[model samples]
Target: MSAKALIFYGGWEGHEPEACAAIVEEMLQAEGFDVRSEAGVAVLGEADLARFDLIVPMCTQVSIDQVPLERLCTAIEAGTGLAGFHGGMGDTFRDAPAYQFMAGGQWVAHPGDILDYRVEIAQPQHPLMEGIDDFEYRSEQYFLHVDPGNEVLATTTFDGSHAPWIAGTVMPVVWTRRHGRGRVFYSALGHQASEFTNPQMREILRRGLVWASRTTDSRETGT
Candidate 1:
């Protein structure tokens, strides 16, 4: 059976959660996933969650009640894959450390806000990084407090042009890890749907999503 994916999106409208959800929903559907998209986290539950093979939380900085957040975490621990990008994954629920812990990172700041930056491939041979090259683009250069347990796939060096204190500090831009039996993936990209329009960004994000999915087939269907 095709894998089932649940995308729960809402929170800071500045991140354009709806547009991001549309992009992800289309990608997953094109890849043969049975996709269900929702507007709020409250609709999620442990029982209904069991039907999905993957969960994509596209929420930005918003509060998720403990019960639902706990249920989502429990589902991921039980083997439901989890994946997201930017604030949706990294900067979500600023007060909830557990969510950040499960995501493997938290956005502390975006030095230079929106500007040109290079994404360095840290793991050139990882499946998620396949067919992609270190590239330059303009977006928020997210400075994150990342978990050491993450198997980093890509990184970016802070030139300190905007935040001089962080000059030359390297940060992880993409990573993957395990949450119990579940696979977890995150990218410090996708500030908005437009960010994914870049071929490299789109390719990397799509590959990461496929890699983090619970399905056994990891082939890229060119979504």
Candidate 2:
């Protein structure tokens, strides 16, 4: 059966959330996911939130109601996969520690803002990164507070142009971590939807979503 997936987008329009949502929705549909799209966190509050196999957050810098926040995190813990990219996931739900704990990271700053940088594949032999080579990208190089438990797959180094102290600092640009029974995958790519045009960026997202959505254990647990 096709995996059930929900994508909610809104918050700061500068992130091009709507376009990112549309791009991801199309990607999921093409991958045979039964995709549902919404404009805010409202759908996360649904009584049967656990029904989806995958939950994608495209909303950046938004506040969700307490119950919905708990339900969303609980659903993930119960085996609903969560996958997202860049600020859409990395910089969202600023006030909620639970959300960050579940998602595995939070954006702190992009010292130099948009610029050219190279993404080095940290785990070259990993299946998710198979055939993927380190690539140069021009966008916001995220400096984040990340979960050390995460299996970092890609990294980027800060050159100290914008922030001298952080120069030579290696930061995670892509990672995966488990939250209870769920798989959580994130990539510090996609400042806007157009970044999806890059084959490497597009493929990482495709692989990340597929990897995150296996919820057989959740179904078996009945949680």
Candidate 3:
């Protein structure tokens, strides 16, 4: 049977949740996942969260209720995969520490808002970064509070041009971590669906999803 993947998208329309969901859905479908897409956090409460092999949350600045939030985290801990990009995953569930804890980071600022910046591959030998080189893209340069345990795949250096305090900061742009038995992958890029349309961005996102889904308990996990 094909692996099941659920995409829950809603909240903060400015993030273009629907558009981002569509891009992610199409990509996962092409990869042979049986994909299910939903509009709001309500669906999260309604479903048996553990049924799927992967969950992609395409939301930003949204409130997820306690019950569903607990189930979602539990599901991941028990071995479901979670992956997403930008605010969709990084900035979601403001009040939920479990969500942020598993995601390995939280979106604190963009530094310069939307602008041009370069992404550097930090672990070129990692499968997620394989064949992907340092590239330039225009979008929000996410400044995040990240877990030091994350296996960082790519990063970007802050030039302090936007925020003087953060100048010379090197931030993780893509990373993967294990939350219990689950594999969690995230990228700081993809502020808009159009951003994913870029070949390089799209490839990274797609590969990240595939990597997350295939991950298993053989991978290490910790606090």
Candidate 4:
């Protein structure tokens, strides 16, 4: 059987969650995932979440009920993979530090909001970043509250064009970590679905999803 993936999206509309979910769904489908999509928070509580190999949370600025959030976290701890990009994962629930802990970071600010910035590959040797050179990007330059546990893969230097005090700051752009036994991956890229058209952005997300998923053997053994 193909691997399963669930994408739950909805929250602040300015982030274009619907369009963003569609793009990610298509990407995962192409990757051989038996993809399922849901809008709003209902599915998070109701779905048979443990059956899936991966969970992709795409909600932005939304609050998840405590019971559902706990359930979701338990599933991940039991080895269900979790992965997403930009605010969908990085800035998901402002009120839930537990959610941020699972995802590795929270979006604190975008200094310039939408502007030109550079993304530098920090772990060029990692398979996820291989052949992915540092590139210029136009979007939110995310200032995040990052988890030190994360194995950072990419970083960007702040030029302080918009926020002078932060000039020369080195911030993590991509990382992978663990939520118990479950693997978690995130990239502070893809502020909008359109950005996925950029090969580097798309490839990193694709590889990150694949990387974050449980191995077939682990899934079968319930590990």
What TM-scores do the predictions have?
Answer: 0.95, 0.95, 0.95, 0.95
CA RMSD, predictions in order: 2.7, 3.2, 2.5, 2.8
C-alpha lDDT of all candidate models, in order = 0.86, 0.90, 0.88, 0.88
Estimate, for each residue in 140-186, the C-alpha lDDT of model 4 and write its tens digit: 99999899989999999999999999999999999988899899989
| 1-223: candidate 2 lDDT, tens digit per residue | 8889999999999999998999899999988899999998888886476889999998899998899999999999998899999999997899999999998999999997899999999998887788999999999999999999999999999999999999999999999988998889999999987899999999999988878886433233211
lDDT of 4: 0.88
Candidate 1 accuracy as lDDT: 0.86
- Give the poorly placed runs of model 3, Cα more than 4 Å off: 214-223
Query: What would the per-residue lDDT of candidate 1 be over residues 11-92, giving only the tens digit for each residue?
Result: 9998999999999999999988999998877767534786789899888888877888888888889988898899998877
Extract clashing residue pairs from model 2: none
Best by lDDT: 2
Tell me the deviation in Å of residue 96 in model 1.
1.1
Model 4, residue 96: C-alpha shift (Å):
0.7
Q: Could you give me the TM-score of model 4 versus the true structure?
A: 0.95
Global lDDT of model 2: 0.90
Cα error, residue 45 of model 3, in Å, equals 1.2
